[model samples]
Target chain A: MEPLINVAPYTGWVYPNETIFEWSVLIAVYPYLTGLVAGAFTVSSLYQVFGFERLKPVAHLALLTSLCFMFFVPLPLLLHLGHPERAFNATITPHWSSAMAMFGYFASFYVALLLLETWFAYRPFIVEKAQQRKDLLGTFYRILTLGSYDVSDKALRYDQKWILWLAIAGIPGAHGLHGYVGFVFGSIKAREWWSSDLMPVIFLFSAIISGVSLLAVIFVVSSKLRKIPIDLACLKGLAYTIWGFIMVALVLEGLEFANIVYKGREGVEMIMEYVTGPLLVPYFILQFAIGAILPFLWLSYMIWRGTTGRALIAGVTTCACLVLFSVFMMRWNVVIGGQEISKTGKGLLSYQMTLFGKEGALMAAALIIAPFLVLVVLTRLFPPWEDHAKSSSSLRSHA
Target chain B: MKKVSNPSLAARRSFLSKLARAAACTGALAGAGALGVGVAKGASAKTEAKPAAEGGSFPTKDYDWTKHQWAFGVDATKCIGCLRCVEACKVENDVPRNAHQFRTWVERYVYLEGEDRARIDSQQDPVNIAASGSEKEYRFANRYKDQKVDKAFFVPKLCNQCTHPACVQVCPVGATYKTEDGVVLIDHDYCIGCRYCVQACPYGARYFNEEHGVSDKCTWCYHRITKGMQPACVEACPVGARIFGDIKDKQSPVSLFIRNNRVQVLRPETGNAPNVFYVGIDKEVN
Candidate 1:
């Protein structure tokens, strides 16, 4: 069937298929979603294994966020597949040499690790809820206990030890998860924008920035929703980490661009034309200017004063949102922008994202939102923050 | 006396022994069954080979694929921009009518004197020479009317069927693969339609077949070639511009042409080692 929209003609020649990018915006969102998962998991590890006490407030929240995002990571991929049902063929008969063949293995292993870590970390709370509530919700918690009723101090110690080890193991797993995503694009030697040794590193650091910023926003928003005082120390520490990572990511990206320009290969002229033409808004304005530079400046000012207040919270929250937006735009520019340039080094193609199609922007938005909904459901089942609330209450009573 | 007293225990022991014996028998039967199937398959293969040796028609199931290395060649100088090859390929392959779904297409490269790069364009259908009176008359009336033309010619584009195909390497499932005979083909049933192969192809020769819901490309007319027929495009070329043959056969026209003429492949810098060779291809043709 013919495409509903007519493609605009440009000077020179393009392969017919070059006029229509097979990988859509849905493909772009796949990496962005996985980046969120990887970034959040890394943040959770800082408190769990590294002894960052100031980060304790959001540690559990971060793990939950990662798990929630992990659930939706493959949805965009499934939607983008021409035969979504045949996707299992990739796992069953995976060609080992292909970078993409590793995805099924990597995603499964990472998700499994995330689930086990989250379960072990929250086991004590589940046992407590199971005993305290005598209704269906209590029964649900009891079933979640997996028939293990042990909540002794010794058992709790074992849980902590295992959680620590899992967090340590997850560090590499998280890196592999997102690094593999970058390799999918980077290993394609055909496209200049993606074919860089720095692609994986850039993806990893950008993921950390996105993940931390997301946690910061969630922390602030959740605090307001629950009518609790914001944890200013935790917020300050997160802002500092975000600032450092953003700088490194920006520098790495800048070096890649500079290297490409310096080399000035045959494809460079066409790529330069692409960057200056259609990609101007997303690459320059959204990604670099608003996404990185503005957030970095605002975060730097916040970190410099060592301040913690309502205004500071509001400001950092805004910066976090911007950073998240920037990281997403970076993915868009890489995935879609790379495809915009025809391989012939003669012409450019335009992408008009369909709104109502199977693999459209609306579907991508739904995939992103589905994870947060899972987080909400998981909050009810596991109650990530309940144990901390209980301890604070007990101390209040004693005092 | 002790054995008689523990009657229930003795009965349980007897039942366990019986179960083990049954399992052993089942295992032996299954192994014999598998061996018998293997022998039958071997016998059938021998029978199929006997018929082929006696000069019977080549059956699809029994055809040995290892004998030939397929290759394609094009003489760009001979091409008159008549797109009969393109139309024949489309009809033969059942390629969709959409311009984007071409299995093969013709590109016209126009390089004016002093221009560093050539200006190129292509149409879904070839310029109709029959409808117009003559080549000179058609050129004067339709194309190059106002502009100064230094050198212009048609280059037919199809899958190069690279030996070290990036598409084959990037296919997560082994859906797209190179055959022993050097024909690159896709298994429609196996393809998950990830489009990785489409992106990995440097020549932009692969496309997602929207109708079939899988990645598709020129297979060098695998069905026709395997049955000892010229590819539709090669058969349709009026000027012998397109040639397809077994490169392994030193006497084949394609091999003779390559041996005699200065031949070049597209995007040699990519290191894909394409089997498609071109003669008289201008550097301006990418």
Candidate 2:
């Protein structure tokens, strides 16, 4: 295998040494952020779409979370593009064979659907509450109504049904949006670890886990903040759901690796570089043990004990692990690990993330944080739990 | 609405006879015209595109005609490792300050079983004609230390412009395209800043033009080829290790190389018909 360059005769620098695979970083962020949006929104929709009465308190909050992230999902890729202004051109002049090209239509359509769902879900609440305000928020909502603000029972029912059906259908669209991200990497035959049948299943499972966990944590936190009774039943059901998906996600990951190790290819040795090298700790410790096993055990223990408080805490903890570790690590492995192997197959290529490159960690942090800020502002404006029982007593206490 | 001066039956008959003759001539011309249209239609199926063809434009002829169009014919039998092509490419292409950003590149990997594997310091472009040294001499390289060294061979690198470019396939926007002449080109104006093509390039040949916000890759010196000049590297190589010409035109030097040698395309399994040929390619290069 005399390092494949024997014929071409290596002679010069490929590019400036300072740039260490900037493109891989961009790829990493698109799927990671999109997965979160899909997961978080799907969690928000569970109560609204599935008619789970207990999840009502956090239902609107979930929608807000989804909206915030849905907007940010495309930011990383946009920033990474050399000519971002021409990004819309992808949609207008799509090449059908390229899977990545399809993202343009899917993203735009999904955004429209999510926006309509968010608006219809909150339309009545907006019309009723807009009467008291002379502020910008109220004006936005008033304009949002297209000058036909109505709080009639029939109108509310119509809006609710519109939202319900949209939310119901939204599940597949969200899954497809997120699943396609996995499909892009999974379909790539160049990298062995990426080209796996379990990739889409892993994406879907992680989506459910991340989505459910995010809502559980947010709901619990908001309940405490507002001094309202937490919805114990919803948390329990969500914990069960999260645990089930986590189990599937973990199993799928195992199968992905087992199949590769079982029927080894030329790429196996190169992929092993991840095992014996830089990704070892991130893969084994963060992804497998602490991120996966600990959270699974904590949630399982709470689910069996019937202790609602413990379950909520464990659910929140699991969400923390998932957000901080799981999905991001999966992305890191695919983008960073996928490239670490050289074209020569002799050994690995050294690629460390640079601070100021287009795909740097600083850019990634900004992208991840931007959604939360958007979500917070939205929560303040709409206040998903503002109609809870506490308002009745506050008036009397003040008087 | 026009008035005829002659009112006699003979005058009217004369006008009718002339008009009838003109009408018959017009009818015969129209029939010939219709026949011509039919013939054109009959010829349509032979030339016009039909969807049922096994392949129209892509899964492209399973051979990259652009990058390898000037396929380098490195004869290992020809003994000499003068770094002339490397120097020429760096100076001509303005290769960056490091050995890693290799457009025309080379490396020597040494394998020793009992001893530690040895990598020779890349005989990087030494002419310094481009004044191409960084502050640190740009030390990012995968060289074996001064450890026990064994069998080593030199490999120079350039774009293999595969018929099926992974970069072209992955570009979200149809910004990157292969030219009719088989040269892969980036339509800078249409390129969205998405770097999928850069990542998807298996050869690591693609680089994002950070200044412009688009992926820029080797055009195999398209500018040079268009002007009847050899790629700077090929022109400068002292050993004639690099060959540049049209494979499509059999008389071209490249076609002669392909004709005379049992050459191999790197990573044929990738289905990217790499136009770059290597007479003595190692099996595991891809």
Query: Which one is best on TM-score?
Result: 1
lDDT (0-100) at residue A220 of candidate 2?
A: 71
Best by lDDT: 1
Clashes of each: 0, 33
After superposition, which runs of candidate 1 have C-alpha atoms over 4 Å from their true positions?
A2-11, A386-399, B1-62, B124-141
lDDT of 2 by residue, A247-290 (tens): 88889888888888888877676567656676788777777777
Clashing pairs in 1: none
Q: Model 2 Cα displacement at A7 (Å)?
A: 27
lDDT of 2 at A318: 58
Best by DockQ: 1
Kindly state the number of residue pairs that clash in model 2: 33
Which ten residues in a row are the worst by lDDT in model 2 chain A?
A1-10
Error (Å) of candidate 2 at residue A141 is: 2.6
